[model samples]
Target: MEEQPLISYQHVNVSLQGQEILSDVNLELRKGEFVYLIGKVGSGKSTLLKTIYGEVEIDAGEAWVLGNAMRTLKRKDFPTLRRKLGIVFQDFQLLTDRTVHENLKFVLKATGWKNRTEIERRIEEVLQQVGMENKGYKMPNELSGGEQQRIVIARAILNKPEIILADEPTGNLDVETGRRIVELLQDICRQGSAILMTTHNLNLLSEYSGKVYKCEHHRLTETTNS
Candidate 1:
């Protein structure tokens, strides 16, 4: 049997502040897949990512993510829909005031993970997955750019989300470090969750194995050979 897409956007249109960002954007991401959105700044890559998690409302066409209709989601339903998504931001948004452990713990608590033991275990698991198993004690300031991004990835997976929406996850690091971050994300994709990452770095497209879509002229089109 064929698997259903975790995210599907059919001719989806999105606008911000009365400006069109993405128009007629048809996209799909499935389980255990890594898809990349490549575009220059203001090309709707980030906006498309936002549409997946409900930050930007879909203006027209059919849009669904993790089984929630993007166009019809209620305000109260946003949190529940978001819980099924893991988001990695361009700026490593770790709380500087907290230890790495506390940062992960905060997300769990916010998402309603009440069991203390399970929270700790899940934290360790995701940290290990991102190669930061031993940095749980360090504060965000103590780690390098790459290490901090790793922690962000760790935090994103705390809920075992079915989809990960990453907005320029490597935009801050060096080329080498950025490659490493993408590699970590790919590993996570292999393990199960589908990842949709937005980036302007076209170099990554050649090295990564995944679907590639480019946003240009208010439209999103698949540009990858795969």
Candidate 2:
């Protein structure tokens, strides 16, 4: 039998403060697949991602992520579900007061990693994966925007999540840097993690082929052309 999708949603309605943002949304993400969510600002791209991560509650329809039913997901179950997923933000939300090593270490510790040696080993591995192994001692301010974003990506994969939700991860970088980031994400996907990324950069779509979904008019639709 075929495996179930890592994420699946059908007729999902999402709202905030009594205002509906997304309606009748249907989508799926499978392992090792790379998917893109493209739309104008405030078109509900981020909100859609929020629902998958359980930040935004699903008002109607079926939504499942990593085998958890999001529509009936409880608040206490959020931490367990989140541990199985990774999230990368556009702004590079690294702790400003900590070194790259400490930042990664913090996540490992918070996620129930008890062994000091294991934590160090995992931190080194993720940094190396993102090509930031040597910069772990540096502060967040010491790195360029691209470097900082790399660290952010590294942080996302620390727990070896089943899926990654990246919200415009390349939004603040130059063309070349953004391309590099996308390449890195593709590499991660190939290693068996599904990725659902939101972006306004259409150029990257042409460079890297994948499933594309457009969010517009409070609706989601698959697109053949970027």
Candidate 3:
């Protein structure tokens, strides 16, 4: 039998402040897959991601993430759910006041990691994974755009999440840098984590060639290119 998808959204509807943003949405993400969500700004791309991570509540329909029914997901259980998923933001939301090592350490601690040896080992591992192993001592403000984003990706993988939700991760970088970032994400996907990324960059879609979905008309739909 085939395994169930890591994320499954069936006829899902999401709203904000009594205004519906996405309606009748159906989507799925399986392990070792890289999927892209593309649309113009305000077309609900980010909101769709928000629903998966529990930032936005499901206004209607059914949604399941990492085997938990979204509507039934309780407030107290959010931390558990979030721990299984990694989130990357466009702004590379690292603490400006801390070094890369400290930033990663903070996440590990916040997520319940207590062993200093284990935490240090994991931090080194993720930093090496993102090719920033030697720069752990650098502050966020000291790194270039691409470098900062790499650290952000490193931070995302600290817990070895089942799925990663990246919201325009490359939005602040140049084209070449963005391509590299996407490539890194693809590499991570190959290592068995599912990725659901939102972006406006259509060029990356063709270059990377993964499953593509467009969020428009307040709906989400899969697409193919010849």
Candidate 4:
């Protein structure tokens, strides 16, 4: 039997401020799979992610994410839905006032983690996974763009979320740094978390391997790697 998709969107449509952003969108992501959404800015890449996480409402069609119905999700249930998924952003949104360890700890506490020992262990594990094990004492501004992104990934995985939704995660880095970030995300994906990332750098498409989808002319179309 085939594995069920962690996220699915069929004939979905979305609009913002009376402008149709996406139409008849269809996509699926399974466990341990890495998928990319490549498109120009304002092509609804972010909008799609928003819909998955319930930040944006779908105008039409059916959608499901982690068992939650996107077309009819409730406001009070937002936390319940978000807790099952991780999100990575293009800009590192780390707390400028805290150390790396503190930032991770804050998320844990907010998410209801109470045991100090367990929180420390989980944070250490994620830091090591992202190759930031030795920099947990530093503040966000102290790290380079790539390092900051690594820290963000570490935070995203602290709860062991089943799916990771990344928006332009490599958009702010240099070529080599961006490649490294993608590689790290791929490694995480291999370890079992499905990832759907949006990117403008088609250069990544030629190198890294994954299911590629393009958002253009108000449609999402999967493209083969060339």
Candidate 5:
């Protein structure tokens, strides 16, 4: 039997303020798949991901995320849908005042993970997954750019999200660090989480082959080669 796509958007159109930013956008991401989202500035890369995560409203088509219809979502319905999604950012949005453990704990609590023991275990598991097990107690300022980004990734996975929607996740890191971070996200996909990352790092994309989706001139295009 054919399996359902992890994320599906059909004939989707998104508008901001009063301008149509994206039109006729169609996409399908399956379980464990890794896809790259690329385009120049204002080409709708962020808008596309925002639509998937309910950050933006689509005025004209169907968008389904883990089977929930995005076009009809309510404000209160965000948490239910967001629980299945993990979003990573390039700036490594860590709380400068909190320790890694505390940062993870905060997210766990917000996501309804209340058991102290389970929270600790899940935190450890995700940190280990990101190769930052030894840095859990360190404050955000104590870590390097790559380590901080790893912690951001760990925070995203605390709820065991089915897919990660990353926005320019490696944009601020060095080339080598960017490659490492990308590899780490790819590894996450192997464990069953689909990844949709938006990046302008074409060099990394050239080396990291997978499905490619580009936002350009208000359109989404799929690349079959490279």
Candidate 6:
């Protein structure tokens, strides 16, 4: 039996301002997979991730994420599709003025999770998942760089997304701390959500074993240890 893909892109070509960014891109991510995306700056790593989550429009070809077709998705449909995806940026992107709890609450409300009890429960659940249940009341600025990132991860999982698209998630952390953060993301993948992370950290790729997809020369190539 063929396994279902959580993410699929077929013959995808992405362009910005009339210049092609990604070309002939075809990829698939199944549930519970931890895939590495490696490329130098100006490469299509970010562009590919954005295309998966519908942030970048494909100039040609197709992208399907958890059954939501990208080419045909309407603006109004983005919120619902986005709910199934958790995105962690290189920058923590936390709301500085709001407490960690409020930061999550804002997304919940925006996504139509209205029941107060359910929202609170889900918030606690994700916080606990990221090992920061006690820091919910603290301001984003008060937390360490890594802790803020953890909260960002927590918020990403609030909706139980089928896939997590993380772009340069550990870019701002120290080497040791970055490994810890990568391990946390690995743990999340073990729990059944596919994770596609873009990183320049060759050490992470070398130290932590997983399938890798390299975005380079305007194409994506899957690697295997022969």
lDDT of 3 by residue, 1-226 (tens): 9999999999999999999899999999998889999999999999999888899999889899999999999999999999889899999889999999999999999999999999999999999999998999999998999999999899899999999999999999999999999999999999988999999999998899789899989999998831
Tens digits of per-residue lDDT, candidate 2, 1-226, equal 9999999999999999999999999999998999999999999999999998888899999999999999888899999999999999999889999999999999999999999999999999999999998999999999999999999999999999999999999999999999999999999999989999999999999999889999999999999755
Q: Write the per-residue lDDT of candidate 1 for residues 1-226, one digit (tens) a residue.
A: 9977898899888889999887898999989888888878988888788777777888899998878888988989999988888999989889999999999999999999899899999998988888899999999999999999999999899899998989999999999999999998898888898888988888888888888888889988888633
Task: TM-score for candidate 6, please give it.
Answer: 0.95
TM-score of each: 0.96, 0.99, 0.98, 0.98, 0.97, 0.95
Clashes of 3: 0
- For model 5, how big is the CA root-mean-square deviation? 1.0
RMSD (CA, Å), candidate 2 to true, equals: 0.7
Show the colliding residue pairs in model 4: none
lDDT comparing candidate 6 with the true structure: 0.89
Q: What's the CA error at residue 175 for candidate 1, in Å?
A: 1.1
In model 4, what lDDT does residue 204 have? 89
lDDT of 6 by residue, 1-226 (tens): 9876888888989999898888988899999998888889889999889888778898888788888888998988987788889999989888898999999999999989889999999999999999999999999989999998999999888888889989999999999889988999999999988999999988898788778888888988887622
In model 4, how large is the Cα lDDT of residue 170?
A: 91
- lDDT digits (tens) for residues 104-160 of candidate 5: 999999889878999999999999999999998899999999999999999988888
RMSD vs true structure, all candidates: 1.2, 0.7, 0.9, 0.8, 1.0, 1.4
As a whole number from 0 to 100, the lDDT of residue 120 in candidate 2 is 91
lDDT top scorer: 2
Residue 123 Cα positional deviation in candidate 5, in Å, after optimal superposition? 0.9
Residue 102 error for model 1, in Å? Answer: 0.3
In candidate 4 the C-alpha lDDT for residue 90 amounts to 92
